[model samples]
Target: MDLIDTHQHLILRDHLGYAWTDTLPALQGDFTPADYARLSHGKGVIGTVFMETGVDDADYQAEARLIAGLVGKGGMLGQIASCRPELDAGFDDWLAECKILSVAGFRRLLHVVPDEMSQPEGFRRNIRKIGAAGYTYDMVFHARQLGLAEALARACPDQPLVLDHCGNPDVAGQGFDAWYRGMQAMAALPHVWLKFSGITVNCAPGTASVALLQPYADAMLALFGPERMIWGGDWPVVNLGVGLPDWIDMSRALLAGLSADEQALIGHQNARKVYRLPA
Candidate 1:
């Protein structure tokens, strides 16, 4: 089946600054669309949505514009640009800019910031505006911050919230029970959807196998159902673990028991619905 990768990250170190990549030697170099197309070739990947690479704050808009220029190439469908909902000033104008670029949605790396960063009323209010402007908000927080994520989702009932990386489960630490409970709570929120990506990174090095990831995958599939679960390659970051092809193979194995239509829903159909992609 053709796949629409909803959480691909592209880094252009020449044009933008990524202070976060300094410590991680694996992600230090540029990962451009051309590179992505080459790696994803013949992998059944037909489209992709660029997930912002957490560039230094000064380069956020530049990062968006850079991706905008490459959208039609490499099957890049659109982007989930970096945003700061905590600051209300110029947010609407920024949204307008994103609309012009045909951005699919927005994301803020909540995991790197303070737990209380999103607690302010203004943050929730701005998130509601993201939905009103016809954009989805991707929630990227650690497994421990699931409750905070759920609270944000509840506060903005009308906004569509995507929980990236299956709530960033702590697979390496074998933190399943707590992750499970947190996921169950997130699943209870109708507006929250889960992105089946990045679990491999959370696994112990060289130990990311379908066998190791099955339970977490099953919980996500059962809790969110096919309609609310979206697939993503997580690309270069995924390279930190089992890599793209292995992850894809593992994903297929996990969904082998499901009907073809059900598999397709998680693979591509739900992405279209959640990101408002063109038919």
Candidate 2:
């Protein structure tokens, strides 16, 4: 399959000014274009979209400029850049300014923010503005944030929302009921799409098994159906458990019985359409 990685991250932090890169050695350090080339080697990966890492706000433009540099860097096909949705006064202006890039979406990293942030009128208002501008919002939430997901989905009925890592499923605990309820709530909103990726790394370090995630996978396939489903390698991030090839292989294994069109949407179609990448 000709794949487009709709959710990959880059790390080119300089001078410790990038705090998130310095926090964890496993996840930190530089993953230059050369590293991504090797990681994506021989995977039939046609392109990729760079996702934002949760770092200090000072690095937003610095990181964005680096992502902009990726268009000529090869392998990068698109970008889902960063934004502070809660910062409303100038958000519309920021959105107006950001459309110049190859960015297909925006994310605020709800998991790290305070619970009250999403509850305010200004935050919800800015979310509507983001949707109004036709950019997908990568809902990076925890299992417990499903309610927030539901709220956001309802608030921005027209926005195309992609729920990252299946709400980062309770892989370590293999908790399904809570996720099941959360997913059901979000799936009821026609605009939401769920990403099936990053399971192995999210599970307990030594105990991730493909079969263990079946229920979650099955729920996603059943709830969102294939058209609303998209695959992501999570790339170097997935390297925390198995490497990129294994992640792709395991993903294919899980979707083995599905029809070809369904497979295409998960592997290529949905991501391509969502990110609006070049053919």
What's the number of clashes in each of the models?
0, 0
- How high is the CA lDDT of each candidate model? 0.89, 0.78
Quantify how close model 2 is to the true structure by its C-alpha RMSD in Å.
Answer: 1.7
lDDT, candidate 1, residue 74?
67
* Deviation of model 1 at 154, angstroms: 0.9
Candidate 1, poorest ten consecutive residues by summed lDDT:
28-37
The parts of candidate 2 lying over 4 Å away from their true place are 15-17, 21-23
| lDDT accuracy of residue 48 in candidate 2 | 76
Task: Give Cα distance to truth, residue 210, candidate 1, Å.
Answer: 0.5
Query: What's the CA RMSD of model 1 in angstroms?
Result: 0.9
Query: How close is every model to the real structure, measured as TM-score?
Result: 0.98, 0.94
Report the number of the highest-TM-score candidate.
Answer: 1
- Over 36-139, each residue of candidate 2 has an lDDT whose tens digit, in order, gives 78877887777777887664787775666667767645778778888888886667877886787777788888887787788787887887777778788888
